[model samples]
Target: MLRSVPSKSQILRYVKGLLITWKLRWRGVDCEGRVVVAGPAPRIWSKGSVKIGNRVLFRTTSRRTSIAVRGDARFEIGEKCFINDGVEIDVWKSVEIGPYCFIGNNTRIADTNYHEIDQGAGPRVDSISIGRNVWLASNVTVLPGVSIGDHSVVAACSVVTKSFPDRSLIAGIPARKIRDIEAADDYIRPG
Candidate 1:
């Protein structure tokens, strides 16, 4: 789990993070527990009125470790949220993640497609809201306007383009319900 190694810019970023943490305390950002921010903090943003509760972690150590921030996009994380390595949360609009959500490694969650699909140039954005206890496997790409319900498990390499109901086990390239998770007695976790 080696990163490119923190550069001098990282050293400066570390100092800025210390200041931001202190400032957040003044602004009522609760962290009585801990927020283990991995990588050079420059790769992560703590702005746009972020309200983080206790036990939240942000990490940027993956194949493409880059976090994009635009406008005053907000990100609110609930308590005990575990964001895995290389997970990119691009907030062009707003992205609100609930508590106890375990985001998988290399999963990218972005509000917009980052380009005009029609190529005519028109604004398009839809926020993403991930519910509590949602387990996402590696290489999952959660697109805009998708709201994953609580206890729902998204399999690896799936592309979530739409919302799913609560407690559903979805899989496939575009992501579909294989079967009711309760119907299975031998559920397996992705490696």
Candidate 2:
């Protein structure tokens, strides 16, 4: 049997993957296991803490994914999650993304308003909790204090401003539950 040879692009990608892995480690990210970075490298700036679980894939393009954690905030992404290109996560408090979730391209998840409403008032900040098997469609904006429940799907270009229950089909500007979907047993992670 003849052995197959790796293409130039394949070899380049392999080298890039190794560089990215080393860069992440140098940046002090808490990676439990392997985290794959496709296309361009991601821009990660953490003044607090950043934790990534095993098998997390970041599919970046020219627009590169960005993650920023300010102050003593925490940012955590669970295992087997896919974060698409141009996704920006800015955490001023905490942002927790569960396992098996899909974050579509150009999606924005922020836990702070970034500016105060009043002169002496502080900016609004709170934690964002995304449950397991959740799918956030492209161009979605998940604002502060929003919790997306398990197995939920947020429609494209939707703005999530409130908490949603499990198995919700959420949509609209300030996202509301279009309907409740039947929970799929297959999505449950095995022990």
Candidate 3:
């Protein structure tokens, strides 16, 4: 279902939210509690549904921060999550990001790429789930039926077509597990 046209009140509230979001960042928004950026402020939120938990960071910068969610789509975020700027999540079924996850800039997360190949009746909905503490690099395209396990890192610009097991480092066009992520100096998060 497509999102209902934005109401005048929604527009006003979105502008207001944008200003407040900036101020909050300047003042350092709270990072230890649940927060929600509802009603599609950074981008159009018609038909878009978002759920944020404690300490979740929605967007960093406002440029290219567009999220186009069709009707009947859901975006669910867990605690201590960071979704960088310029990220687009086009949802159909639901996109669930576990706690302590970090989604890099310019990342695209969608349940379905488009309507079924043979038929254009409508886009099918799928769910994208990112386990806890998963780190995704920039320009990654996570397609439908894909899930990344906890403590995993996906290299930049990789197209994920399938799910990867936990504690793995995946990269490349189709996204293969180059190696199981071990102790590292560049990217390391508390257990």
Candidate 4:
């Protein structure tokens, strides 16, 4: 098999990603493994802890992606995860994403409401745990305190408010379990 060489644009993108990764590491972002920015660079603001695992691709070809960690909050993305353009993760408490997860474009995952309903109290803060091999489609919004089990697929434009079991195919405005994915491990996108 003949191997094709990367184009000039691809080379440039890789170089830019390397620079961005170095900058982020200087700014206290903990990247445990090799991260590839296949698209545009992402905006990462980490005041607490933001750990990204190996072979994690941030593909923001259309728009910029953002990850913010405030106070003592921790944001973690496991190995072989793919995060698309315009995706944002705001961690006020903690937000953990397991391995081989796919997050589509314009998705938002937050661990806080960001503001207090009552004047005297602080904002509602909770942790979010997303299991391994989960696929979240475009425009999906995962709210605070939500725990999505392994091998789950959240359809486009869905709002995940609560928890769901393993291998669930969830969809809708307030996302519900539409069906169970029996062959969750069988589906894999070709390179």
Each candidate structure's TM-score, on Cα atoms with residue i matched to residue i, is 0.72, 0.89, 0.71, 0.88
RMSD of each: 7.9, 3.2, 11.2, 2.4
Clashes of each: 0, 0, 6, 0
Candidate 2 colliding pairs: none
Over 137-186, each residue of candidate 2 has an lDDT whose tens digit, in order, gives 99999999999999999999999999999999999998999999887756
What is the per-residue lDDT of model 3 for residues 1-191, given as tens digits with 9 covering 90 to 100? 88899999878756665564555444433223434353333553536565556755566445445656567677767787777788888877888888888888899888886866666556655688898789999899999888898889999999999999888999999999999977443343752
Global lDDT of each candidate: 0.72, 0.90, 0.73, 0.88
Error of 2 at 18 (Å): 3.6
What candidate 4 gets wrong by more than 4 Å, as runs, is 1-13, 117-122, 184-191
Candidate that beats the other on lDDT, 2 or 3, i.e. the better one: 2
Candidate 2 displacement at residue 142 in angstroms: 0.6
Query: Using TM-score as the measure, which candidate wins?
Result: 2
List where candidate 1 sits over 4 angstroms from the true fold: 1-33, 37-42, 59-66, 119-123, 182-191
Over 1-191, each residue of candidate 4 has an lDDT whose tens digit, in order, gives: 99999999988877876786787688888878667897667888878888988878998778989998888889999988999999999998999999889999999999888889899788889999999889999999999899999989999999999999989999998999999987546555332
| Whole-structure CA lDDT of model 3 | 0.73
Give the distance in Å from residue 166's predicted Cα in candidate 4 to where it truly belongs. 0.8
Provide the lowest-lDDT 10-residue window in model 2: 182-191
The model with the greatest lDDT is: 2
